[model samples]
Target: MAVYTKRDFSVNLKSHGGILILALIAVFHLWIQVTGLQYTTAAKTGWIIGMTPVFMALLGLAVFKESLTLIKTSGILVAFFGLILLISHGDLSSIDLISNKGDFLILGSSFTWAVYSIVNKKISLNYPPMMTILFLFLMMGIIISPFTINDASIQSVIHLTFKGWIAILFLGILCSGAAYVMWAQALKEMESTKVGAFLYFEPFVTVIAARIVLNERITLLMILAGIIITLGVVLVNVNLKKIVLYKKSKKDM
Candidate 1:
């Protein structure tokens, strides 16, 4: 996530709210991994996770008095359509899209993340962002401890390799804990949509990460999809005046 600051531009969002965010994310990841192993298809999982922002935006408007601008709403819709395209492509009849328990877990994860985002906006006004994050993580750590593996024979129940262990740990520490804190701190300073816009990048990042990790081929369709998504992101964030000026400059050239 990118940082936005009105006053102190050098403030570190990561140092403040990242850990708590990460803990919540870690829980989500754990749940998804467990559920996905027993399930198939990615549609249900995506729909569950994907619905959160709309929910969160509603929460913000209802509870926090944050207005949803038309432009912002359009951006959200465009991003979602892009996500659908990227995830489903042209497969309209794939039952695999609706077959996973991971879908419910992902939905739950989004709900928790929504709670975190709303609470963060409220509490950041009263407390240090980092302190709030620290306490949240501590609370999560306690809550999640019960789910941790305690028995030896249970290993056979959920088979995991060394790489999987590493993945889980990294997800917890870096993506969950650290990224959450960074994002929270950024939320304190930036407009919500500005911070939220970074999520559009996540699909791209995942594709790239997957390609690197899985040796997946990057096809022409994927490249075109990326270009369309990039254009959508620009439309969502770029200033209209700047866009006009750029067009004029191109015409002059």
Candidate 2:
């Protein structure tokens, strides 16, 4: 896609920074996420990964001096609580992370992704989105090549079924390629905190997808949690001044 887009391959100091950010993004978003999932339940992974928005908000305020409005802070807390409810299924005791290696790894990934999003918001504007994502996939392949170039990896790929190939293609194309391009474009257009808020929907989408794909049963609690997540996202994106002025205008009418 990057090649087809036909952007110039210019190199500069700022371009180097873009490359470094893309490398970090590739490592945390792809490598750490995949590794952490190996050690944790999908539900737990979803919940842990869902914390990226909260981390982004906190890190933005701390590192970048970004403002944390009341609405945004409340939304982060509400969305985080909703994630816990969704993943725990009303049993809060099961939300243990200290003993689980996978949980820690995923937690680290979540934090790194927040850092990446905040940093990338400024850096991504320097290059074309598709080109940056193209370099990102390249960096991921290079990082994994040492581990995946062995005979076992080769044999595994050789033995992969047609369905497995299709799945791999889907992940490579849609999940990594297209998703990163869209994320980059979003960061260019909106605040990183706002863009991160949309990530809260990931687990909500996962739940619905699981019901359809894995035949997993969705309970009423999960539905309620989804609603809460949606509400929190709305709050994060709402314009308080606009709402106040609109309300005053209506009163005057």
Candidate 3:
């Protein structure tokens, strides 16, 4: 990204304090997410994550002055309810099981992610997505290095199994790097509110991955909740122009 920026001084990248702040935010977000998994099931975490779009919408409205419509607002509610139902397995009492604190940690990660998305979206308006995300990755790497160094050694890297190397490369390059770049670009191209609706797909994807990789059972209730979650996201993404036209058509009667 710096290569394409055409800046006379490479040091200019350091001038973007927002990227530095974004890196620090990423650290806490990553830490809680990884550490919290020890205490809670991934299924519960993904369900909690389904609320991310609502947080994004709220932050967009409050910080960025993004507007909310009746249609989008209702869509957010429906999707969130569907998400809760999915997470709780249709029993609202299941929420009380979150008292274990891991769920709260997951909740914290969600808020951090919302802040990260909104901030990244705001910064992308000024800096190119590649530059911002690359810088963010570099800074986060520096911040995370010390904490991880004790767990990793030069010998471990040198002697890593081919499969282990593949997994590391996939996570570092594709999942963390490329995925974030695309997400930042999407936020740049669309409203944060709309960009966030895509997060509703995470749990479904996670479920599918679990079923295939871990041989987890996929139940009828899961199918029902997945459909409802998908419908809610579709509702949120529906164009306001079409909604107005539909309403107007009804009013003509």
C-alpha TM-score for every candidate:
0.61, 0.82, 0.79
Give the candidate number with the greatest TM-score.
2
RMSD of 1: 7.6
Number of the top-ranking candidate, with lDDT as the measure: 3
In candidate 3, list every pair of residues with a backbone clash: none
Candidate 2 local Cα displacement, residue 199, angstroms: 3.2
> Which is the better candidate, 1 or 3, if ranked by TM-score?
3
Q: If ranked by lDDT, best first, what sequence of candidates would result? A: 3, 2, 1
Tens-digit lDDT string for candidate 1 (41-90): 33233333444455466567777786766764675576556544544444
* Model 2: CA > 4 A from native: 39-48, 98-108, 246-253
Q: Name the TM-score of candidate 1.
A: 0.61
Structure candidate 2, residue pairs in collision: none
Q: What is the C-alpha lDDT of each candidate?
A: 0.58, 0.74, 0.78
Which portions of model 1 show Cα errors greater than 4 Å?
Answer: 1-30, 33-59, 95-97, 100-112, 153-169, 217-253
lDDT of 3 at 152: 58
